[model samples]
Target: MVVIGSRTPTQIDQVPSAAQIVEGEQLREQTSTGVDLKTALGKLVPGLDFGPQGRTNAGQNMRGRSVQVLIDGVSMNNSRSLSRQFDSIDPFNIERVEVLSGASSLYGGGATGGIINIITKTGEAGGPSWESAAGVTTGFNNSNDFDHRVAQSASGGNDFVTGRIGVAYADNGRHYDAKGDEIFPDIAQSDLQGNRSIDILGNLTFRLSEEQTLDLKAQLYESGYEGDHGVYFPNLDSSTPNLEDAEIRKGFSADREPLTDRRMLNVNYHHANVFGQDLYLQAYHREEESSFHPFPYPDSDGSYYFTTSKQNTTLSGLKMLMSSDITGNVSLDYGVDIDREEFDATQMYFDDDTTDATGGLVHEEERVEPRYPGFQIDGLSAFVQSEWQPTDNWTFGAGIRRQHMDVAIDDFQPSGQSLAEGGKSDYDVTLYNVSALYDFENGHQAWTSYSEGFDLPDPSKYYGHPGQSVSDNPLDGIKTRQVELGWRYQGSRWLTQAAAYYSWSNTTIEPDDNLNIVQRDDKRRDYGLEASATRFLGDHWQFGGTLHALRSEQKIDGEWEKRGITVDPYPSQHTATLHAQWSDMTRSLRLQANRSWDYADYQGDEIEGNTTLDLIGSQRTDFGKISLGVENLTDEQYSTPWGQRAAGFYSPRFGPEYLYDYQGRGRTYTLSWSLEY
Candidate 1:
């Protein structure tokens, strides 16, 4: 039964048995707020570590290896940074999220870790239907945010179409101190704090004939944030001015404005009886652009002091898949994929006082155009898999993939200087996986597997800077080795799962001293144990919990001074959450409570363990639905990966002397109402 809910294997034949489908509904519920997918998943899945930090996206660590994310079966992780955000997709549009907990190279290079697939909504064969809903909420810290959404779908004859569009806007007020009297510093002032987003989605499907069908999909997303940097400054003269007044005098010095826009288009066709087997073909293109302007200031001389940067990315790919039943007890699946990606970036520096130091201000303006340049990457992969049921209680699966990658910088220049006269690199990778599933007589199952994964060097990493030492000598690709064993039991109202895994990676890529280029040659290993359980407490109550214990270590092969320079970015051990939900006889009213714990061992040297609690009550009626909730009931002080100490560094450094703060939101409450049609 669990296999039915497990992630669909890319090779089709290497499907999971009964122990891999653990977090589905829980993932959807945790991500309802448009938070980063990794953060949401971390709350439910054991052995997963994720939080907001270095970049806007969530960083993920699964089974001691990095994890890659895919939206609608398309890779979303930026090849250069390995960071991506899932906020662009509306939660309402997701059909499901499938997490494959181990290394997988069959999908393509770049997945030296695990993989997550986000499946989008698709029209089903039926009639026409329309749905719409809207909600508004006001919470503690004077927080007020509202969300409205509407969707319509229909299927007639042999054609089907569906469209969904939504917009969400929030203006979260400043948070107060522990005593609930003073406002926290670094937070945006009451006048400057707010965030807004817009999302649009469309999909159309046409049945060309009995053996062929066509599908088209497109999506657009835009979001912006206006807020102060999460930092507090001591008053210049504490004795002369009050903290509030002193902050006001500073004129909201710490502020950031960021804007992001993204679009995706896809066209796919599926046909059966093509070349005597079921065939699938798809074409997809995605474009994303983002800009950030921090601390924009209008100077006295009609000039502005600002720092702005823009990034643009484009991706296109085509894939073909075929499957056939070779025998009564055996099946085969094969596929080929070709993908290309390009990225371009620009950063500008301007100064208001263009003239030399003097009383007169010069009108001449100078501009510095530092081009990030652009590059192209081509990937080709072919894979074959077989599933064989040799016995009544056992099943065996094996798959192999041969992949080739070609990367080149297209007219790449660093500050207008040529790099390697346009460089290119090619690599070949071979990956194999073997798995077995055994079902006992009592509805219990066990599984064991071994798999390999790899990631090629991205073009950006090789061509970003010219004449840079390490940039001149590109490193080889990265690779991972993984082995896992797990067991599962499912009863009428109770479910339990447990697993243990060990993973090792070679030539890990990491930022060097320059921070402009990355160097490879680091080795790392991760081993962990994880368990989860969900059970019914009563006729109307259900509870669930997940726990994890992990150890990760890294070693850089260099001089003694640098040999131990290892950083464990993920929590070593943690108990994610405990949640319970109950409903009264009326079925119209419901209550829910959740508590999460991060143990001391889970926190880095600079971080401390903290507990968070949330409560919610909802009521439904003919007119609409209403819900009230409170979060951070204890108002605990904590910091996440997003906390920072250095002025230009986005990542927070852990340690007592670092003087870093997490700046978590204090106690907050919310009241929401929804109208449905």
Candidate 2:
């Protein structure tokens, strides 16, 4: 494997001077759980958190701050909500996952946490390859599903052009309630509640000459969800026979369908001069849209009602990079990036007078309008980094960046009342990092670093409430100070890594008791230790495991609150993924098993934790590859991070009764197949 960056190329399997790489085999091993990129990295990296299932819209919090996600060096984060879900792309098309852990303001804004770069498959010149796969499976609950995927690529000519294209699709089935658990009759009758996705990607690379090259790429993604919400509730007491009238059970049947559409285009150029200096230029554009509909209620006139919400966002950027070797042992990289984003949202209400509450009359006109104020943000940043290698086994690195930002909000009202004129804010900040690594005997290395990071206030926070005057106080950005210490050991048959890190953040963003608007000035601290090891047990078996322990604290208004606050909800203690796989043991058979445990954590008023087991077996041959697997083998119950909202409880609400929880899928099984030519 070769590691390529905006500036230079580095060797793999060695202590990299300034870049990171993961081999293709490592990517395949990590993607055993279908196509969940986030979960695939949980065992390979520390200080990365993955939220529970059902919270599909939640973003990833890296090192206690929201991180930026990219594909082939192009940013892919949503401009409006900043959601960072890995489901946007299929894992089957990925070649590797490169994570630049720690503050990286030099790359771009919104990377206060870190940077995740996804590298896709590429076709080699003078080579041709193609692959296709299709399969079906059934499990204990409603786990019967189908999947199909295909990819093809061809390259020729020594220097003219090379291109590749790939596509994938997946349809998943829902899981049933565990034994002894009562199924929600209304939901049981609805369509399957699972995810369906389609992905399309294309790339073309042209070598203009020996000193220059051009690359163009595009991607399209669509995903959908069917059926009712996953949560459930028991019947009310006999005194409340109108239990049917309770907010939780008001509807005899409920269902919803949400969809997302995304498109991206990027173009890049690289040039090298006879003087050994290198330069790069890149321009990109992205657009995304999401629509959600909530099931409407039946009115007295026997009519059904529904509400529709949609968000549209667009982002575009250009970047320039240059690098050169100043001295025999010193090198420098400098770059500048500029970007802009625009966001808009709309909500619509619809009613059907076909049926009544008990066949009663329902009459209302469909009202559609903008749901939030429209906004735009423009930013510019420049940075420089230096690497010095004074000895064969010692290296040092340092980097700093300055960023300027301007945000504009158009005149608009959230509710249909008076218009609130838009406003603008400007900010300039600086960030820096320094690190050193020392190589020891036997391919081992120790490293340490100090980094500074910051997160800009989200644009949604700038709007004023209907009754109060819009406050002039701009949203305060969060500042982070981080310290890290770690070591890595690589051997012929084993690989191990251990790291410990602590981060302190000031002016962290949090919602008040009412959860109406976001506020800053809160303080949060997180410290954690993690270790992972992978070993080849004999010639046919491979084993690996990861263990982590973390502690967090938050201070509100100068007072420390250890519990009952909705700040940093990650579990303080957890053990993930102990797995063993036996491959090529027999003619064409492989067996694998894994176990994981999570400690209780609070999400608002609900506590969640669970232990899960999984098993898999597969057969391979010239015809194709087939595999079967089971997940959540114990049928453990759990709730996701942003699962539910309490009924009629808007602001300052507390207690379990006032909390709504999202439910997780039970035990499930899957069968898959793949063919290559």
Candidate 3:
């Protein structure tokens, strides 16, 4: 009902951009902080901007660019993405979450601006059904910081076989904010939020007779952590100035259990009359791996050594689809896509003196990663879309796409050879989009759209320094242009939406927080306005709200520079969210609040803004359902505008104890229970 399913390319029944849908009964009333998906999409979506202790991504800036995290549709970044991709999985294997919000010229090339699809958990349409769930969350300033979760599933089969199986697990502890500190971990953070996670899923279907169908799926995810003491900080002499005890974390050592693993597999086939068209076919594969153990090197005789780092990413794909009906009112959809990818990194070293001048812990001598190369990519695509409705409420759509790309690099060398020894990057381009919609009989609805998207350039800038090649125009691409207008209403209880957008870019890219290095900026501009509403007060109460405003600019020295305006980025020109709910029947209760405003950082200076409040309650019975939640109810001692712009631009020039460990995990409380049959 929140705009029917979209697979675009002439399947347009509706679309004008600015789309959203959360379902899963609103993820069971917010599963008490929901446990990632960036904490349940930071309160039901709105140009996302978290980290006021809600952490997910402090900059996925939907309307300002950056977004394209999918699940059932594959692609979880990994093409050199470092937004941590909202903790991979475990929203209890989600079953809903679809947001468009901006730029999606047929869902290609980093989505240029937005698109997040997460659709999992399937199996239920006839026969046997079983679902089980569990939950726990703790914090009132430390009950050992708590976290827990468990899940199970069982689906049924008939009509020639159908199946589903699911499993889940999560564990966490150690989190403190609102003056209670504790988050100072290191190494880019992500052991699924540091320590413990597991998920597995499977599904199968084969209904041959009913128009032919076939499906298969598999997935696995893992995260873990181990530390002996962790945390170390001290003004490192950045022109010292009485630092706040180096932001505390007291420098200790030992950490040899940092891991992450991900896997995926998929297959599909459907037909409902081929030649006349309705066919669909697909194939997929994925893999991701990460590791970091003991890091602290210094050997050449002076002793003390430890290093073991690794990362591997592999992706594979294939796809095809068709849809036809051209006559009575028009219809057409087309597709063909292919992809292959690999990203690899390595590092090794051992010997950390188990007791004396480094002898007892030789640990299989090593030293392999430093200028390591290995980045590959290949892609091919084709597309077409069409839709037209001449009567009822008028609608029209258009689409086109063509993509071809190739980038390669392997052959490594030069730990010291003066530089220049790597190369490769091939290119191809063609992307397009157009839209329109209107449906009013008093219910209201209106839309308009134009889209084009692109992004590519960051193969560690050609195999990360120390000698590089391939840069003159491997068909250079990094373009974006978008425009949008929208309005919607679905009364009977009230529901509303509004949108306004504008975008321009020739390029934009960032990275350099603690120096991961990667920056590119060129004429860029972004504009925005968004509005939302929901109402129902009759039987028990209900009210909802949302508002967002944005602005981003660039062009450097020639004026027009407003990227984070002095540090406090996370795309916050203005943001607001309000919620209220109360129910009858079994029982339900909800309360939410959010706000972020107070801009001007990119050298313009001035940053400070925060407001948070949350609460959730539920009760249902027939043998299942119970929940309670409270997050930062008021314990806001805040600090998260990406940790106040990384402690106002790198804490005193890079060492104010590196403070800004997102000080806002404060007030927290949660309880959960679940079941269904």
Candidate 4:
């Protein structure tokens, strides 16, 4: 398979570092269980943490750090992440996903961990074709636990023009835990349950000439949930082992739950041969609006106060790429990228007594304010990469990128504070990478690489404070250095890949006293090992497994210590998976098992570990194809690593009910049917 996350297409086996590809077919098969892309990716990619599978990707860290998300080579990342990148597109319209592990600046900021590139479907060369699919998921223990989805698409192409269009809709319901108890919505970050979503995708390509083409892509995705229950606190002094979960208060409602709305339009022009080289240009625009959960806090008078916030983001960018062949064994790729981003948040205040009398939180229009000063980032980048095959068995590559950006913040007033002046900061930096791969005659290969990555600290965190001004140049982009060594073997009946990596940086992204994201000046280190192997038992039988172990620490005072949840939210040190598959032309069956090992929290407390199982099967019939998937087959009871830490941290400050870590979901069964013509 070809790996496109590297900014250039290359053979997967030729990649010097760790990487993986999830085919669209595989994605469809996995998502048929009603899980989102985050969960599906976690099940396939080693070293990627799936977090709590909530509405937000708050804890979905890739290789112990942040990941840059993209669709068709266009970035979907904002300064603050907002953690809603996954909601920008539906899995049903994706062609494939390419993942490149480790820090990289090849495509610019937010890749401190790695890159996930979603390739959308395009028209095929032939007559018109169409597909329709429907699916339902439920925990089986409750009537309200059912979720339903439907999707349809059509693709066709001709010598001059081709296009593809798809639409998907889903009505999500409640979720259940291992004990068949209703899972409460996450009051802070939000949950995916109890929402309605719709996604629309379109792609059009025009063959301007035999050697040139133009492509246009557009997408719109929206998901929203109106809360019908209010958050209630109970068990103010419960211990960890005896903590009670938070209960939903009926007849009370939040003014608003959480919401996500995203839209994108992209155009690309390509010339297969531009003066004996390939030239590609892209122009794109994206707009996003997201609403966070309503929060309640105590006022100076001891009365309750409420606040709700929403973010609005606008992005526009242009990119150019050129590929030239210097010789039969040498090639060069160069590109320039220019982009601008505008982000701002608005918060509305509510009075407790008024909200109570109104039966829900009542928005006070006069009390609205900017949650943070609006910010705009304008960036320009230039890069060149080269690859050379010195010998038949040896390949080497090198690349460098120069980056420049200007961050401008608008003046604003924080709550209970006067206006603070905002200013602009200019940043210029250079990043480099090199790699080598040696292929042996026996289908064995070894490779090594050193790469650098850069990131922009979430500006909203620092600018939203009392001072209103941007914090002490904390926007000074984060720079990371990483080294990796990998080995791979591709034999007649087996395939294996393994890698060991170590990365470090001088600055760490963590939370401040007010629980806002901030960049701290401290040396940090992250090391990990990952491996995957697959064996072909026979024509119709195969087995595969993966293992990953990561360690994250930071220097504080004079000692090196494990990073806390506030610093590194996803601290699951070890993960393992095993699966067996049997497939024929008309039918298939698969069984998979996953385990998260017990690990010590930053407080030196042991977090319990758990394992889960999944069973999936499919059969093709004359009318359509039928598939069944059972997730969490054994109904294992466990707390996510992040959930454990959150429970410990929020319990005392807010009620012990916070100690109820969002428990893992119980066994769920999904039934789906699809037909294509």
Candidate 5:
């Protein structure tokens, strides 16, 4: 979604100038590593890819595409774009993170490989206030392996009214790595940081007079882990045959439940002069769901045993925007979007496991009837952007958008499955953009951009098993094209920035697991290079870093090629991260280092790459803050090229193997304590 904003200001400086900002003191300085939001944007954004399990990052990817994930403006990329939506929320309830790269989304389908809003926590500034936080993380010779969290908040107001409320809880366990072993159990995105959570949110603002204002919000997040030590790896049955010696099991007859429950609600209306423009109205609703447990393979042979794969989405939207000033240089930003979605997608099978992988239990449970019918969407959009400045640092921008969609499906066949015929699909698209900005009196700033993006397919491939017809399916929509160049400099202690990009897309979908379906790859493409620098060595050292270099190709034979996992697996393409710090006003220290990118798997063999370290510390104690973190500070244990890429189950008796290549999180630690009352 793109915004020209009328309100909803979480200070990302109204992003634009291409985009990228992950502040809030860089996510409150990690606050003890596993506050998972895709592991705090894979340790502070840079392209993206997270898999080393601190629990779950779903199916990480960003650069290889599919990136949308918002909070505060709702939309956790549901009906496909699931990277489990980064576990819905929780990264100390963020307060910044705006990244927008590639097919620059300014309001169009789920931003193709870009857009991660996330802005939470709105409080403070005297008056009535309260905050209480807690933490206790583990892994370092496993102190009974742990993770415990707690949070509470409150805020008050005046000048009309204002409000805020918050709640949080966590209690994970078992994550030993760093040679302490015990991580095994990534049962397909079920690691849920060992699961157990609850989060709540609230906000209110009503200043209905002085130029108008009305805001209300609500959020709820739930996590799960109905247990029996979840752990699985059984998609096997291509005649086994070695299959990389597969074996890592658990829960063989019912005893797993990994879950995620998300909810959101919002209503906004603002005005600072509506007749002349500057009004913004919004209505939002979101309901995201996630579930897992695909265990099946315990003597009974060939796939069959307590299955459960759920996905449910429900997003409702309404946005009305306006911004003005169309003279003396021009300015405008317009918007209109109305969305509705409802997807079901389920796969549940349970005739009652016979309990076999140790956890003994033999019995009878029954209930089976879930043949994925999912799909029921409706969308409409409108956009207009214009910003021109005649002098003083020059600037120019242009925009266009028009999208429409309607898809309906749900017929589902049960009992003796087979025969099918359930369809309906529709789409119409047109998205565009342009940008340029210049400023230089020394503190340089330069910008350049071009964009387009779209996505339609993946409503679980529109009710599955379509065979053909449905307009040749591949309506997979998904179109993206982009180009970018950026430069920045902000002196005053030292600052630097750089950007380069190119993108191409039309079709891209993957999931063959030996012909289980979903396939389409009309040659994807990508180009990258990003850079950053910072320094202030004076009042106690400080340094900053970020460097990414990607290529992500895929056209095979006719040219291109270089896209592994047969063209897209997600993770690494020359990365680099480094940060250093030393504070004042109450002790603080930080350091992080990354250096990954050297991959070749899926026959090309050679999966070697390493370099990781992290450390953080803080103290402002007097009954207040105290923190410490250490994530993979040197216990490498490699794995990142799609983690171990061999390309999971290519079939025909183990032809292309590498079912979740495992191995990645070692060395970890966390400890925290907070307060603010």
Candidate 6:
């Protein structure tokens, strides 16, 4: 199979890194479990940490680091992450997902963990075709706990032109835990339940000539919460600690609700041969507007004020890549990228004098101000890589990239803080990677690689602090170095992969004791082992499993210790997943089990772990294809790692609230129907 480990397409066996492709069918099957893309990916990928299935991707990590998300070839990430990259698009439009594990400079910043490239569906050479699907989900705890979804797509093409368009809509409802308690919505980060979402994807391709082509693509997605429920802290007025979880009170009305809107457009061109080299070029634009839930924060003087936050971000870039053969045994791939990102955030205040227990009861607007100084970052980069097959069984490759960034910020003080004004900052960095692969005739391959990746810390967060200076910037870029060793085996009925990796960075990002975002110039390291195996039990049955063991630590006071919840909040010492599948032309069945091992953090908190099971089955009939999914088949009771971190962060300052626990949803059932012709 062909894969793009770098910009150039190459054979999977020739790639020096671990890579996996989740086909559309697999994605559909996973979606049947009524989980979002983040949760679905975590179950399918061994090294990816799947946090609570929510709208915010707060604790989700790939290989214990940040992951760069991409749709088609356009980047969905900016310096100031909204933590909503997974919600940028609907899964119905995705043809497949490509996952490249470990760190590398092959892409750009924000890939310190790895990369997840979502490939959208494109029309093939065929007559007009259409696909439609509908699904419903419920936790069964209450009559109101029901969700609905519908999607449709159409595609048609001739010899000269081909195109496809798809649209999906979902109306989600409330959720409940195994104990039959309402799952409270996260007031700060927000949650996915009780939300409505819509996504649109369209693309057109033209065969300019036999050796040339052009493609145009666009997508728009939006998700907004209904705000039917609000958080109620039973201990809000109590001085003593209360063990009650944050409760969800119904009929909580609000004039404004949290929302996320994303828009992207792309123009891509390709030529089979240009000056004896294959050429590819793409120009893209991505824009997003995100608004958070309004919450009340107490001022130093004791009065409380209601505030909401909104962020607008835009990214535009042009990328070009060319591949050529230097000789029969040698090849070179090179590319150049020019991009710019501009971000702005605003905070809106609401008069709190008339507000009730639920925040933002008073609709009277007060004022609006910049949450942080607006900023624009421009980057220019160029890279080249060469691959050589010195012998029939060996391949070696190396590459380097030079990046230059200029950050410009508007002169403004952080809200509710006395801070130095923002100005300009410039940075230059060069990153490199090297790899070697050995292939064997017996379907076995071994590979080793070393790579470097980097990302600039969120300027908006650091710049919002007091006494900040552009020259004395605390938003230093973090550079990570990674080394990995891996082995892969592909037999007639069995496929397997095993890999070990370690990554280190001198400067780490974490929250201070007061839950304030901070940058610590201390050495931090993350190490992990990952493995996956799939076997065909028979002509119609298959079995597979994945395993991951990870640890993150930092040097403090000249001693190494496990990172705390504020830093490495994933809390999974070891995670494993097993699955069995049976399929035929007319029917299919799948069963999956996932387990997280218990572990302790640096603060000596015994983080409890849990296990869950899922089952899905489908049958095709003359009317349509019908499917049913049961998530958490055994009704597991567990608190999300992110939720636990929330409790840890709030307990010291406030008191125990039910919402702080972030309990996992209980058993859920989804029924779906689809038709394609």
Top of the candidates by lDDT: 6
Better candidate by lDDT, 1 or 2: 2
For all candidates in order, the CA lDDT equals 0.54, 0.58, 0.67, 0.81, 0.66, 0.82
TM-score of 1: 0.80
TM-scores, all candidates, are: 0.80, 0.84, 0.34, 0.95, 0.35, 0.96
Q: Give me the overall lDDT of model 1.
A: 0.54
| Candidate 4 overall lDDT versus native | 0.81
Error of 5 at 255 (Å): 11
Model 5: per-residue Cα lDDT at residue 181: 69
Best by TM-score: 6
Instruction: Enumerate residue pairs that collide in model 6.
Output: 245-657, 245-658, 246-657, 246-658, 246-659
Error of 4 at 362 (Å): 7.2
Alpha-carbon error at 35 in model 4, in Å? Answer: 1.1
User: Tens digit of lDDT per residue, candidate 6, span 122-198?
Assistant: 98768799999999999887787998999999999999999999999999988898988888777667788889999
1-677: candidate 5 lDDT, tens digit per residue: 23322123322222334456677656767656554666556656776654445344433566666677777666677665455766666666666767765665465676776777777876644568887878877765645477788888888887777888888888887666567766555544456545787888888888879899898889898988744454443333235412233444343334336688888898888888977878888899888777775544333354334456677788898988788888978878787888888877666655433432332222133554654666777888888878787887777778888888887766666566563455787778888888787877587778887888876656554445633334345355677888788887778788777778888885666656432346576667778877778889788888988777877776765776666553343434566788888889887888888776675633464446678778888888789988888877888776544435433433233322333445666777788777887
Instruction: Give the lowest summed-lDDT range of ten residues in model 2.
Output: 183-192
lDDT of 5 at 478: 74
Error of 6 at 434 (Å): 0.5
* Cα error, candidate 6, residue 118 (Å): 0.4
Q: Which residue pairs of candidate 5 clash?
A: 2-106, 2-107, 178-666, 178-667
Global Cα RMSD, each model: 6.4, 5.2, 23.9, 3.1, 23.3, 2.2
* Superposed Cα RMSD, model 3: 23.9
lDDT of 4 by residue, 559-648 (tens): 778776556434555788999999999999999998887767556765566899989999999989999999999998767655665665
